[model samples]
Target: MVRGKTEVRRIENAASRQVTFSKRRNGLLKKAYELSVLCDAEVALIVFSSRGKLWEFSSSSRKLLGETLGTCSAAELHELGNQLEESLRQIRKRKQCILAEQIAELREKEKSLLKENKLLHEKFKGGNMLHLNAAEVQSMEVNTQLMIGRPGTL
Candidate 1:
């Protein structure tokens, strides 16, 4: 079956646009990888999405990505595994540090709020409330008129 050429234009729909971008980007990256492997050429491709997200493919980084390992011996693979584990450990440590800092900040905020609440509770507990008599309540009857627009006009 013959295929018609797709028109080169920005997809109007946001979801369709993102989908097309993702598919095309993957295809391009795969082709770059194929070219590098098949021709024994060093290939480096970098793509910046509309939202400033980055997609990159480098032959040098294939080992880090675990893409190519045909030439890697047992020792080399073991070293690569160790390197990956170390990288993961560092990442987890940094994540824990940030989480700890955030937890400490939240605890401090909770303490401050609790202190403020206790002060407010003590102030209200001492009791400064109105205790009006029957005569006073009759004298100060509430007006329940609903007003709208300019005061006198409405």
Candidate 2:
């Protein structure tokens, strides 16, 4: 008969534990080999058994676990750095374009505000113009100052 489901925690029985360990160790090594083959990748796996036996596997011996991947020579490193720098430069160029557009929009808003201020000031002066003469303009300025509770020389 088949056994029921078992928890993944500590195995209690000693004989069953040994059998499980051997089976899992083989399975893990097989999986590592299959992964390296199927993915076309540099793979390394280090496994230590319960008896302290160490097992390791790698696709290449020269390019070990501690070694950097894909870059065997200084030329490769320089080429890779250039490619990365160009990509970053393109990203910065796009950011600069966006900021330039925002600056143009702010400048347009400033111009609109300046134009609106000029129009309002013209309208206020038109309404206060009883006569276009200099003396009449002076008198109007004095009257406006008095209305706003300001002392006027006129």
Candidate 3:
């Protein structure tokens, strides 16, 4: 007969729960050991029981793991810091180049606009105009002259 799948939930009986925990913990430790041996890999396992009992397994000694990991982490952190600093430097350089390019483009546009404005002013001044009085024309001419000499005039 095909058995139905067991519903996984917390065991209500304290004795059954303890038995299950013991079985599972042993199975897990066995698997960990098998994996380390078969793969020739470093493995560590730590388990705590409800009774505050601690179980641990490691392919390497705890002191060796601590020392090696501490040194590796420090070296890795230093390398990472250097890489980040270099990346930031490169980013700043690229940003400066982009800003310079934008500034040059804006300067060129400003110059073009100023030239256009000067031409328009000259055209207006040369044409006969009955609407503008002498003072208005003089004021316009003075403003045009000021704008032409300025560096950032639009």
Candidate 4:
């Protein structure tokens, strides 16, 4: 007969919990060992128990971990650094190009505004002179009427 799947919840009994922990821990360590041996891989596993016990597995000697990492060639590191520097240079160049384009556009706008302002100023100046001439003529008429003894009929 097919058995039903077990629900994976906490085992409330202390003895049952400890037994489960021991079984699972041994199984995990065995898997780790098999994986390292079968695949010829560098593996590290660490487990902690409810009583604060530490268990660990490593495919290689503990001291060899640092040595393995330190085996990278200086030339490789230098090449990586050069690649990063080139990327930064390219980014800066692109930014400068964009800024230069913006500056050119702003200069064009400034020139257009200056030309429009000059034209408006010239138009206003011509109109202002006509207004001033009309004011002068009115003033002269008022003076001449006063000289002839006429007061309010200008």
Q: Estimated TM-score per prediction?
A: 0.47, 0.38, 0.40, 0.39
Write the number of the candidate with greater TM-score, choosing between 1 and 4.
1
Residue-level lDDT tens digits of model 2 in 39-149: 987666677777898887876542443456465677766765675578679979997998998799999999999999999989878887534788676665333523445
Each candidate's lDDT (Cα)? 0.84, 0.75, 0.78, 0.77
lDDT winner: 1
Give the 10-residue window scoring lowest on summed lDDT in candidate 4: 61-70
Total backbone clashes of candidate 4, pairs 3 or more residues apart or in separate chains? 0
Tens-digit lDDT track of model 1 for 34-96: 999999997767688999998889876577666778889999899989987997899799979
Compared with the true structure, the alpha-carbon lDDT of candidate 3 equals 0.78
- The residue pairs in collision within model 4 are none
TM-score winner among the candidates?
1
Ranking by lDDT: 1, 3, 4, 2
Q: Candidate 4's residue-wise lDDT over 35-80, tens digit each?
A: 9999998676767787788898888744222334355577855664
lDDT of 1: 0.84
Error of 2 at 61 (Å): 3.6
Q: Which of the two candidates, 1 or 4, achieves a greater lDDT against the reference?
A: 1
CA deviation > 4 Å runs, candidate 2: 1-5, 62-154
lDDT of 3 by residue, 1-154 (tens): 9999989876999999999999999999999899889999877777879788988787753533233545456776676567557867997999799899879999999999999999888887788554688987787743354445658756
Better of 2 and 4 by TM-score: 4
lDDT of 4 at 95: 78
